[model samples]
Target: MKILELIRPAYLEVRRIGNNIRRSIEYSLSAKKKDIKIAISTVLGYSEQTIPKLINDLKKYGFSGNSIYVFEGGHNKIEHSFAGYHYYKIDHNSFDLNGLITINELNLNADYWLLLHDTVTIGKKFKKMVYTCQFKNFLGLKLLKKDVSMNIGFYSMPLIRQNSEYLHSFKNTDYTEKGLLNAKERGAIEEDYIFKNSQNIGYVHYDLQYRVKCENDVMYKGRLRRMEYYPQLDMTKYKANFVTDKEWIIKL
Candidate 1:
């Protein structure tokens, strides 16, 4: 077992290299810059106050305001916060429910949908990260969870074409049923494990939020493991290594 453990990373690395080559070939033959359209969506319920600033930051960080969608399920709905931003209202005021609702009702035409939350913030070159990712078909994080059992939530991004399949799979039978998030994320975890998307640059709730308290925290290794050699990732501390890099998120 010890020897196998020692050999696993090496084996995974070799396999990753092979997969990268295949992905590169596929990307070269199939992908074009103009063909990729990513729609950024976020749910606002408790954090309505932060929506305006978040919008400003997104535009300031290089995302066109028109490509961003804000779903409001809060006490107040502020429409057209940004010039081209799209605002929609939900029937209920719950992030999990509202988010899922947005998924079910996504009418816009885009190749992919990026689901973000209030806690996670993006900075310069963030859109480039999304555009550069090589996933052909997936609706979860780019790849990997700390454990197979970990649930994927708002941070999970799905391909628009395949949304009807996985996104709608975990819908609660009864509207009044509880633990909608648990149901949804558990479904995502199961689906992602079955799919096992190849190396693509993306982040989720954990990659940036699961931080280290002690110097020896495994997230240090986890962050190091998830990364690819990209200058943009290295240029910004906001990319990953939340724990290893001592950039822990303070939840509001």
Candidate 2:
């Protein structure tokens, strides 16, 4: 199996990015891939001093294989957030995920792509989750599906060789300003709305422990721990749809 992960570090704090990269290295080591590619994307606005170090650290942190490719861009750059942290922004109009698919000519071949934030960590339990999911799917779970569904959380996901085809099909579709505006008006956050509601995008909720350092210490100020699974909600009501402790299903 071939694996690849996309890392966007510009929106994350330097210290947080460092730790995230460290954890990514540890997670990569635990993966069972015949070939792996770490596709890292950084912004153009980051201090020239910091981006290179971060890239070097990525290379040092166990992603030195020839398959690794670093792609840099500033298109999604956001100068501020609603909370007031001046991190990169996510402009609904300017953000382009197609670039991620195109950067390494990812559209040319089908590979299991794991999209990730630069400030998240993947530990043993998380690694085990991916392995188990792949095992089950390899045994038949995903093969039965005909349409493309997306799994949420950038932590881990399974994309068949045809995922590349799905990406291109999505790219050719039109993006209406009215639709974008309506999406922004909705309760959905920019990234979530785009990834979930978009055409041909199948999503899954990953039940894995992920650690995040919020843009503000205040967001996590009183929390005993800053780690939790994606969707971060009570699951008892939907027990039939989830394992309660897992993160790979895209919510029922």
Candidate 3:
């Protein structure tokens, strides 16, 4: 190996150390001390049944998700209690894009915003991988999905700064595309746009591209169609005819 290539790893380590120290000094010297470094935001639908379990897991790491501001899109109120967790009733389903917009209006005071998918299950590696990133415009569990063709695609959470360009990007379909698609596709397209124009992007130092995947008891796992595999879930929500992005079959 060339001498430059051999020294690159050492160079990166030095940079990381420098950045961490600079970050610490900046936080310490700031006039308004931010008690919370990360503000957690999420959208809830049927995810109500799963989030508390994830919250419990987060506690094991000694990382409290201070003041979880959730946008509730379901008819029912959240029934679990965790400190610093609150939900606001909204007029839509548990869609991430709208939830993000709603969260934006609140103007949370934190060094970073951590957006989370309710069904996503993260491991202990999550804390270290995420906390180290303080200077990026975007940080997610992974990069946008790419194929062998080197195509960048949709991505999701963990956060954006309070004054990011992304917070201003989601107005309507007219904001990007000329015409409108479904809400899901519109959000995906918006995310891809953000990825393409990424000012500064970072990823969690994960072994796999995605260290965590959506997981709940019989979680809905599909890009298109869905199946309600959990027998314990209320099937009454499906009895009436519905037009949805997913065609869910009551397999249970």
Q: RMSD to native for every prediction?
A: 10.3, 15.8, 10.9
lDDT tens digits, residues 172-237, model 3?
A: 323212222344454544443444555445443222233122232332333222222111111101
Models ranked on lDDT? 1, 3, 2
Clash pairs (backbone) in predicted model 3: 115-158
Candidate 2 structure quality by residue, lDDT tens digits, 156-250: 12433324455343332213544433322331223343344333442232332322223322222122223333322110010111222222211
| Residue-wise C-alpha lDDT for candidate 1, range 1-252, written one tens digit per residue | 999999999999998698557645654653334333323333333356446766777777676766677765532433344456776754444443344445455555444445444434455756544544544433444323443312222232344334455545543433233443444444443544322443333443222324322233223212332222222221121123233433332111
Kindly provide the TM-score of model 3 when superposed on the true structure, using C-alpha atoms.
0.50
Which one wins by TM-score: 1 or 2? 1
- Report residue 106 deviation for candidate 2 (angstroms): 5.4
| Cα lDDT, all candidates | 0.43, 0.32, 0.41
lDDT of 1: 0.43
Between candidates 1 and 3, the one scoring higher on lDDT is 1
- TM-score against truth, every candidate: 0.48, 0.37, 0.50
Error in Å for residue 224 of model 3: 11
Error of 3 at 159 (Å): 9.2
Question: Highest TM-score, which number?
Answer: 3
Give candidate 1's error at residue 205 in angstroms: 15
